[model samples]
Target: MSNNPIPIVDFAPFLDGSAKQQTADQLLGSFKSYGFLYLTNFGISNEEVQEMFDLSKRFFALPHESKMLAPYPEARTHHRGYSFPGREKLPDAGDVAEMPLPSVKETFDIGREDDDSMLNVWPPDHILPGFKELCLAFYWKCHEVEKNILRALALGFGLEEEWLVRHHRMPDNNLRLQHYPSIPLESVLTKKVARISNHTDYASLTVLFQDNVGGLEAEDPNEPGRYLAVSPIPNSVVVNAADFLRRWSNDVIRSPMHGVRAPQDMVTEDGMLPDRYSIPYFCAADFSTVVDTIPGTWSADYPKKYEPMSVGKYMLKRLADGY
Candidate 1:
């Protein structure tokens, strides 16, 4: 595995503000160097994290037909909604045609659950009581964790604690619930390439809450032949920066590219049932925000390196291909 290893930052102090500046300094080092980290010790509780994972398991357990009722094709939510395993594509890949075999997975892409404007398409009330409420709570909690990390990131960058976060007000965000069907050791896995293949997320940072069973890998850019397994650190949110952030940082940080290959034990509800779950929260700037050069982030020699981009358009395009 190449790319200098992704750093690790202990957030326990940042959450409590003990040696606050010190914590911020640690954050700066990781973001500036690798743009990815395994953050152990934050304010979010294990029970809360478990609750979110459980909710996702329940949601993804529904019959395939039942989950398909809420497609985003006509909803016009910038193409956001419940996505079947094969319906979505990674924007960077550009291989949108159907594959001989479909993805052995299912998912629900959700954002700000409590915000009235961002309502999720639900299975009828009779089918699931209190489901939406639970998801909303999870979203809110993840948002809290995300904010704490962002503040730490801002301070690490030698800026006001709130400097980086303010741009995310009414943030561009999504909480995804993924269920990778378990496969047998001997069987060749089946997969369909979506147009948005193998790409880095475009958000400022992504927080992944993974289960003990691991498959998440970061492609080693320096040595494409190998992959570094991102081992699950119980209760820790695995955060990584996107291309936009690396560009904003004037290439100081690395925007990694990764993907989910077939899991080893995915039965219908293996990850969605009594056990197995991996949930990730992606955070982005509000669509209206300008994602040009990050303020005070450039020098005369590196003056404003990027063209201005509408937060929504840049991301919408990424999502169109994959995010």
Candidate 2:
């Protein structure tokens, strides 16, 4: 067994079909124990990942006015555009209607091309040539990898491999690019705000790719209030279970709470923390699909812990609560 609390799983075995069952068994254990893992060999090349990062840096470097051309909607439900730092609020100290922390990060959220419920916001070709085309292509590529993981999860649950994949057929997911710029170390030390406050995701699952400047941490399962740093491994993606999956599994797989904090050792001589960047793909289910405990996940020993709920309703409520 690895000394690291979170295991690293190679996805090649699952895709090749040679050791699919063995791969699924390891995945099942990770989800049940840590609710998170580092996944490698799931497709997508390092060059492609770096290109996305380069695009993000260029986009964020633009003048504030120019970047704001594609504005975030006033309605939280319509989440497809650029959000300036501190624009989003998330619960950190408590679970309440009003979240207490204003994250010190800027974000650009992209949804599926065919999502008719809300229009996508993007910079014109003149501003960034081929930006939309590249992002869209990358979005679908990530989805292909997502489907494979869903299939693995289904197989682990003793259901058809396509079971979870079918539920997420609709294009209702989010691809977010985040930039946490350098900030004074005093602000972090005083607990005035965070790069991203401690909170669990609202989606079914999240696949995260982060740069070398690492500060992401998962709440230690063995210690309630403490956290364990999740260092960045080159070319690895961090995968974690989220709220909707927790509900669907009837608490069989809990969503791990996580957040990012500035590393003290990396503090600059000028008392500033270095900038950090990350890309997270939030995978969700079809809006109208009703989420209930998966088959074989509950019984007399563990009855269904949640009521049936539609993904749309659940997502809206969670988004509203965060704001």
Candidate 3:
């Protein structure tokens, strides 16, 4: 809240050949600095964003039994469907032995329905008419935005503009709808539980649309132990580099740690909490795509820091560790 910590970038220039390079440079600077950026004029409209949020609210409002029709374990195989609150805990950077605090959030996950291996789970059409279609429409919109960003990122890294797009043809991207329910004041003040634990995303990039009730925070790039509030910006989407990108870039780009806290002003006079909603599109390359350090990202002094791994294997390992 102090001073919008993340830099804002206009994405419209990326479409024009004359201004494309400048836009790519700005994106590169933001990636190297905070690994987060607020993007506006990216083609997805404000009305579309609101529609997605409304649909998400409706989905979560369904009866618990109805929401659980697509439950975990079965849902875990394809990483789709509903996950109740308190089911996930993200451990800190070190000390895996230490138990992690359970996240105070419920999530519904969906992936590209076209992929047989990553088919999505949906409620009955009669239960929520047009829910699947609307959600998929939003998902593809976000994915389109993601593809354009990746092209700019490739330019940022001095690689072919199509370097990333070619490999990500059939990405294992996911659309996740997160709901952080309100909690009692006493529990919040004393327990210090966060809606989500501080953690880095496991994908190559993430495009997020969050409602006005802001609580997202990104770790300061220059100052450790300090964080910058990433409040929602009107007509913009928050995009961040993730672990895979950092690895692929040979650490030239960072995947900063981020978490969600309950908004202080969200508590009512009676201490009731407000429900917070966010939709994040997690983008990654194809499962069989082998990810190694990209060209021109490594030097003799700064050698390749990670071993090459298939995208699918690495993603599965990260998912298993967290879920």
All candidates' TM-scores? 0.83, 0.96, 0.95
Candidate 2 per-residue lDDT over residues 70-186, each given as its tens digit: 999898788888999988877774345544778899999898877888678998779888888888888888899899999999989989999999899986889988999999989
Error in Å for residue 7 of model 3: 0.7
Q: Write the per-residue lDDT of candidate 1 for residues 239-264, one digit (tens) a residue.
A: 88887777767676678776654444
Clashes of 1: 15
Q: Tell me the TM-score of model 3.
A: 0.95
Tell how far residue 191 is off in model 2, in angstroms. Answer: 1.3
Candidate 1 stretches with Cα past 4 Å from truth are 1-5, 74-80, 91-103, 113-119, 184-197, 221-225, 262-276
Model 3 clash number: 0
RMSD of each: 4.4, 1.8, 1.8
Regions of candidate 3 where Cα sits further than 4 Å from its true position: 75-77, 92-98
Instruction: Kindly indicate the candidate among 2 and 3 with the higher lDDT.
Output: 2
lDDT of each: 0.67, 0.87, 0.85
Supply candidate 1's per-residue lDDT for 163. Answer: 80
Clashes of each: 15, 0, 0
- Return the candidate ranking by lDDT, descending: 2, 3, 1
Q: Comparing 1 and 2 by TM-score, which wins?
A: 2
Say which prediction, candidate 1 or candidate 2, comes out ahead on lDDT.
2
User: Which of candidates 2 and 3 is the stronger one according to TM-score?
Assistant: 2
